[model samples]
Target: MNEITVSLPDGSKRSLAAGATILDLAASIGTGLAKAAIAGKVDGNLVDLQTPLADGATVEIVTEKSPDALHIIRHSTSHLMAQAVKQLFPQAKVTIGPAIETGFYYDFDLEKSFSPEDLEKIEAKMRELAKADLKIEREVLSSADAIELFRTMGEDYKVELIQDLGAESVSLYRQGDFVDLCRGPHLPRTSLCKAFKLTSLAGAYWRGDEKRAMLQRVYGTAFADKKELEAYLARIEEAKKRDHRKLGRELDLFSFNDEVGAGLVIWHPKGAMLRTILEDFERREHLKRGYDIVLGPQILKTELWQRSGHYENYRENMYFTTIDEQGYGIKPMNCLSHMMIYKSQLRSYRDLPLRFFELGTVHRHERAGVLHGLLRVRGFTQDDAHILCTPDQLDAEIKGVLSFVRDVMGIFGFDYEMELSTRPEKSIGSDEDWERATSALLSALKDSGREFEINEGDGAFYGPKIDIKLRDALDRRWQCATIQCDFTLPERFELTYVDADGEKKRPVMVHRVILGAIERFIGVLIEHFAGNFPTWLAPVQATIVTVTDNQIPYAETAFNTLRAAGVRVQKDFRNEKLGFKIREAQLQKIPYMLVVGDKEVEAGLVAPRFRDGKNLESMTPEQFIAFIQDEVKSYR
Candidate 1:
């Protein structure tokens, strides 16, 4: 008998036959583990339980306790959904199914659309199939044979996918009567996908091309157990209530119309005020940190973009215009202009670490289907900055950016996590440059003592980056800040600084955004605070209400006093009931309300009430101004 040595993660070894499978190994260790195992990791790569072991290979059983288990379950559930859909509607042709961050979705081409009831039927069928516990089997077939088989079943979409793969052979998974072409590590049986539900349905173009056939995409989610699924559904409900778009309309912050075109935001008066407050804070903060403010033209000549590599790598997402036979490209990034500034004059090692800041608005050619409120927009302003530093200063500059992100996010009361994204498949620059850049970011993150995850192949086209996603009150994560380290752009533009040895060397660049996009940050803030902004950021910080017509004079005086003190104040001098005015103010999400009545007028004081229904003791105009200033300062 041929024997193999299997190395465990804990440095233990087990002697087994070379042909033994992961399932066999698990059963040998413990029956409980064998039952819990969904898959196995052979030398760090996920594989199915039935995968045969090799000599001296390290193996780890992947169970429900594994971090990757949910993704695997969700992916397997997507396939089960396709199978169920096929069983219910034989006319439907499945295109692709994949697991997403939220859950899973499968696109299908059918003559008729799927109604809500159809989703129910498909879910019910999935449950039935799970109960049947059908064994899922895998096979490898020649591309020709696979295409012929799918073609025989009238699955033109599958045939097209297989033909496009351009591989000699393909992997296929079959469970009972349904089979799918996939490179998979699916659950051994359908029973593992029991705790799942069909979420919603939408229309997606085949291959995302408008000219291609439009397919119906069915979204769903699966969990390890029923309780987990229920918890996720509860979060979904809460997310709906905290949706920024709903709050934006309710609070009259901003709007978008067909007349203004999609993905373009028209800020209302209150929204503009909110943005103004944020911008003022941003400018002051940047100045305090020794950053020099800068501005760039909206559209630069196309030749400049080509020189910066944006034309080659990012042209698809950029807007280009031809003016009087001359070509120009609207800037999708602020880094280009910052780079030109660096090259404008001779820089020495002593003048290194130049930080340039900009509140620059940029336009992107985002697809219409993906645009949503202020979160995903065509035009948005970024709290963007770029730093040029020598190689020796790279680590410190990265740490400075991290500190800036921490402080800004703290001010916003946002709990965030960092992700170090490595070089992407389509990115430029040499391996050595990417390696150096990634190392600097990693070292900075470690030195900061902040926990960060690695997101492979999700960096910018020119460099590796650290993406900071903030967690809202509802625990939903939003990507709002990023710190990117680039070595390619400087090289592309031939940027150099005289070193201590009097030799010119390429300088490193750091492209970072503290608040990502102004519009998106506002959207996140709206949801985070549930439209009830804090005193500092509130559009209407305080509202002065007169209890009676006689108190109008005092209310006017109070409003004027607060306004002169730099508070965003509003006045309600109508003959409406006092309670009605207060209720309206509370509904408008003002942080404070000053009530002026007979007693307040006589004492030359104002009664302050919080939007939370807490009343403070009466204070004179001077005292009230001092109190509000203290509170605002505390927030800053």
Candidate 2:
């Protein structure tokens, strides 16, 4: 046999027959490894275990312990599910299926809706198929032939996909009588999808197009082991309990109405007050950092957007209007206004590092299906800021933004991860500018001494950026803050400052948002605390509950006193029982409940009952104020 040399990831070389497959190499190495190996990576590309080896190729066998193994298993599991569905309901036609972040989902074109019992049956069939251990073989065929085959099978969606792809050849995976069009690096056999479960079902538009047919989507998750699957299921249960949409309604925070509009939030009184407190805190922090608060018009001329590159890259997501028969675009970002402000006057290098901040409201055209409560909305406010500085001060400004993000996340008790996103395919700016911007972000991340991963091809259209994802109490990550370094915008807008030599030089622009969007941040916060906000951030810090109508006057007086002392107080002066009032207050998630009874009123004191059912000794209103203030101070 002709011999070939293959290099392993650890710098070891193996001489094997040219016709040898990855599985053969694994078995030759060790029995345990061959048994554990699910797939292999050849020359940095994932391939099936049975792929033929070539000379001077780099190979790495992927076992259950590999990070990429779960994804492969999940993708294979989705195929298994599709096969199971076909076996149970032959009339059901399969569409597209892909492995998502949570797990996987496959869409099917069927006349009947899938029920919970159907999911169980399909799951049982999947297990049966896995037990059979059928080999999954890949074959390449001309697109024309594949289209004809799917057409004969009554799978119009598959034919549509093939036609839309416009490829001359396509890859198909076959397991017994089941076959799917895919560019697959699937498991060698069905049994490798050991631990799997069908999660839920929903309706999705074909290819996310409203005009296309609606397909039934079955969601599922698979793991390398049973323990991991169980843990993921537990997280799903906890996630359901902590869903912000459910909590928003239960806690009376915000609402969306069909009558008004879709993807629009209507904040209730309590919710509005909570938002006010957050905005005030943001203003104070910005002022302390020497940011000049600024405001701009809600709309600008279309020519300005065209010049700013927004018209070319972001026009689809922007709302346009006509003012006096002239085209204008609704502002989707606040950076343009800040740039105009900087250009309103030319100054020396002494005016460098000028920071402008705004709690600016902007509008975007968010799709209806993607909108979920406050998480995705059409109109929302951003805690946005822009910094104009000389090139020498760019690094320090970038570091300052990272510091702000760290401090803010810490204050909210959020553990976060940072990622540096590089230039995308659909981006502006020259290669040199992108490299400089990315390097500045990389240096800042290194100076901060925090580990960050690189997200290739995921930056803003004009620049590279640092994205911060905060992990909530449930351990789920939320993307809420970002720092973008832009060299293109300054040049596009011709923003310049006079240097010491009196020469015109372009200033660097930094676009950042501590809380990406007010609505989304509040939504994340709701789930992070499970509707139990801290004393300082709570809508009602204290609620005074009276035992009976006789104590209403004292409760009223106590409420006034607490409110006068700058506490957010609510009075429950109804003719209800003491336990009933306390239960109501606890249901509202109020931090402290002041119980006003005859003994407490006579003693010139009010007993404090915490939301957690802890009872404290009676104290004067002044003393309670001091105690609450101390708690607030602790948070700061």
Candidate 3:
């Protein structure tokens, strides 16, 4: 037989028959590897184990332990799910199904909406199909033939997709009696998708267009083994318990009303207090870091947005209104006004770095379907700031923002990851400007000594950015802080500074936010702490509970004293039993509960009980106030 040489990932070469498959290569290496291999990567592209190996190509075996294994498993499981759904409901038409970061989902064009019972049945069928160990084969066909095949199968959505591709040929994957249009690099057998579960179902618009037909989306997840699947399910359960919307009502923090409109948050008293505390912290931090607090109008002339490229690139997310026969666009961002501030005066290199901070409230036209509780709300306030600096000062300014993000996230006990996002296809500015902006951000990220990922083509419309995603207690990542380096915006707005050499130069703008949207951050905080906010952050630090009505006077005195001393204290002198009051306070997640009884009133002291059922030594109200202050200072 003719011989061919192929390179392994470890840079070793092996000679095999000319038409050798990846499976052949694996078996040539070892029986152990051949048994473990589920897929392979040939020259950096994933392929099935049976794919023909090209001479001189580098190959890496993908086992269950490989990083790529889960994605392939999840994607194959999605097909498995579709096959099961089709078998159960013969008339169901399959749409797109792809693996997401968390799991996979497939949309079905069926008149009957799937119920919980249906999901159970579909999952059972999937397990049976996996046990059957059906062979999964990939085939190529001309576009015309593929369309006819799908049309014959009554999968109109697949037909439309093929037509949209306008390709000469397409790939399809088949297992048992089920065949579907896909770009195949899937599991070779159904049995490999054993550790899978159908999670939930939801309604989705076909191709995400509201005008299109609504389809039923069945969501699911797959793992390499049952143990990993169990762990993920446990986390999902914990996430449900920490769900902010549920805790928001239970803790009396925030709410939304359909009458008021979707994606709008109405902060109750406690919620408002929480926001006030965070906003106050932001102001103090900014002031300490040499940022000047600034404010801008809520709406600007529509021409300004057009000049900033928001009209062309971001108009869909913005709201516009005509005021007194003049068109105005509600601000979706705070940078435009900050840029105008820099333009208001001729700056010199002596004042090269000017940081303008604002706790600005902005509005966006979020679609109703994507409107999440507080995270994806239309109206929210951002701890936004813009730093304009000379080209020489750009590096330090970027690092300063990085340090700021580190300090703030550390204070909140959030472990975060950073991503350097490059320019997108719809972005503005010359290639040189985008390159410079991206380079500056990348340089600072490297100097920070922290690992980050490259997120290509996800930058802002004007420039590149460093996006910070904070991981919460349950290991879920939340998008919070961002540092955007924009040379284009300053150039467009004509922002300039006098160079040391007596020449006019445009200063680079670094737009950033530490906490991002206050509403969203609070929601994250709620879940992170599980409503058990630390002493400093709790809206009510302590509630004064009386054992009897006779101790009301003492409880009232303690509350007044604590309030006067800057403690967020509440009085719970209701005629309820002492245990009941304590239980209620504990349910509220208060950090401290001061128990006032006749014995304590006689001694002019109160007992402090922590919400976790720990008791502090009995002390006078003044002493407790000092202790609370010490605790707050400790956090700082």
* Clashes per candidate (backbone, < 3 Å): 0, 0, 0
RMSD to truth, every model: 2.2, 1.6, 0.9
Q: In model 2, which regions exceed 4 Å deviation?
A: 163-168
TM-score head-to-head 2 vs 3, winner: 3
Candidate 2 total steric clashes: 0
Q: Write the number of the candidate with greater lDDT, choosing between 1 and 3.
A: 3
Local error of candidate 2 at 129, Å? 2.0
lDDT of each: 0.92, 0.92, 0.93
Per-model TM-score, in order, reads: 0.94, 0.97, 0.99
Candidate 3 error regions (>4 Å) = none
Tens digit of lDDT per residue, candidate 3, span 392-507? Answer: 88999999999999998988999999999999999999999999999999999999999999999999999999999999999999999999999999989988888989999898
Tens digit per residue, CA lDDT, model 1, 1-636: 589989888899999877999999999899999999999999889888989999989999999989989988998999999999999999899999998988999999899889999999999999999999999888999999999999999999999999999999999999989999898889999998968988899989998998899899999999999999999999888888878899888888899999989999999999999999999999999999989999988999999988887888889999999999999999998998998899899999999889999999999999988898999999999999999999999999999889988998999899999999998888888999999999999999999897899999999999999999999998889999999999999998999999999999999999999999999999999989989898889999889999899998777878888889888899999999999999999988999899999999999999999999999999988898898789889988
Off by over 4 Å in 1: 430-432, 496-505
Q: Ten residues in a row with the worst lDDT in model 1?
A: 553-562
- Which 10-residue window in model 2 sums to the lowest lDDT? 547-556
